[model samples]
Target: MTEEIIIAGFGGQGVLSMGKILAYSGIMQDQEVSWMPSYGPEMRGGTANVTVIISDNRISSPVLKKFDTAIILNQQSMDKFESDVKPGGTLLYDPNGITSHPERKDINIFKIPGAALAAEMGNPKTFNMIVLGAFLKVKPIVAIENVKKGLEKSLPERHHKLIPLNIEAIQKGMVNVESVNSI
Candidate 1:
């Protein structure tokens, strides 16, 4: 099986990091993976996006026009990638900064309150992990153990102490995701 995913958000929202972690998790599961990131010059508050592909077989390229999943974190992303989801695919989003909601009926749409959850957890940095957890809940592609390992690998040693908190955020997201529409 192959899953093509586009994760898009404003810079500093951990969009690239989420894709990287997901790619690493896929690698830990012995799958072919590709992670390509794009962002504007202004780093923070600028548009950022990453495309990740995970497959059981060979991956020919990292570039893609459409995706099996689109994980959106902001209004700009919702506007940009909502229509790029393949028919019958999945679209997971965090309803934090969205002004217009998704309206597609062909694909599945799920929303997670990542920002609010992160704030409640008293660490807004775990917002990405929470969204990742919601995505995993909808599509159980990689193992949780691998995700833990990926988190450990992606974060620096100095930040290693926050692993448990991130895990907790993931669990919180897993249980809090709400289905907007499913097909």
Candidate 2:
């Protein structure tokens, strides 16, 4: 099976980091994966996007015109990626950032209060992890245990203690999204 996901937002919002975590977790799971990030000048405050491809078999291309899932952290990201998501693709958007609700009948959309949830978890910086947890809940391609390991491995040594909190944040996000989807 193959899954292509796009994560987009402002540079400091941790969009690339989220995509990298997913790619690294996919690799840990013995899956073929690629994380391609756009290197543009506006990365500081402007848009930043990362494309992650995970597959059980060999990957064909790193570039994508369509994706199975799009995780948008800002309205600009939503506007930019909305047209590119494939029919029946999943969209995980930050409800606070994206003002316009999509009108597409083919694609599925989930509006999450990811940043707020992270702040509620005691670290606003963990917004990316919150959204990452939601992504895991929706996709389930990578095991959460592996993702927790990835979080520990990928983060700096000084931040090791934050892993458990991040894990809890992820669990909270998963529960939040699951409850929303159920209703």
TM-score of each: 0.94, 0.91
Give candidate 2's whole-model lDDT: 0.82
lDDT of 1 by residue, 1-183 (tens): 999999998888888988999999999899999998864442365889999999999998788889999999988888888999999999999888788899999999999999999999998899999999999999999988999998888889999998898888889989999999988
Expressed as tens digits, the lDDT of each residue in 1-183 for candidate 2 is 899998998878888888887887887788999998975554565789999999999999888889999988888877878888898788888787567866676777776789888878778888988888888888898999788777777889999988888788778778777322321
Per-residue lDDT of 109 in model 2: 74
C-alpha local distance difference test of each model: 0.91, 0.82
Off by over 4 Å in 2: 39-45, 178-183
For candidate 2, give the lDDT of residue 105.
66
Clashing pairs in 2: none
Show where candidate 1 strays beyond 4 Å: 39-45
List the pairs of residues colliding in candidate 1: none
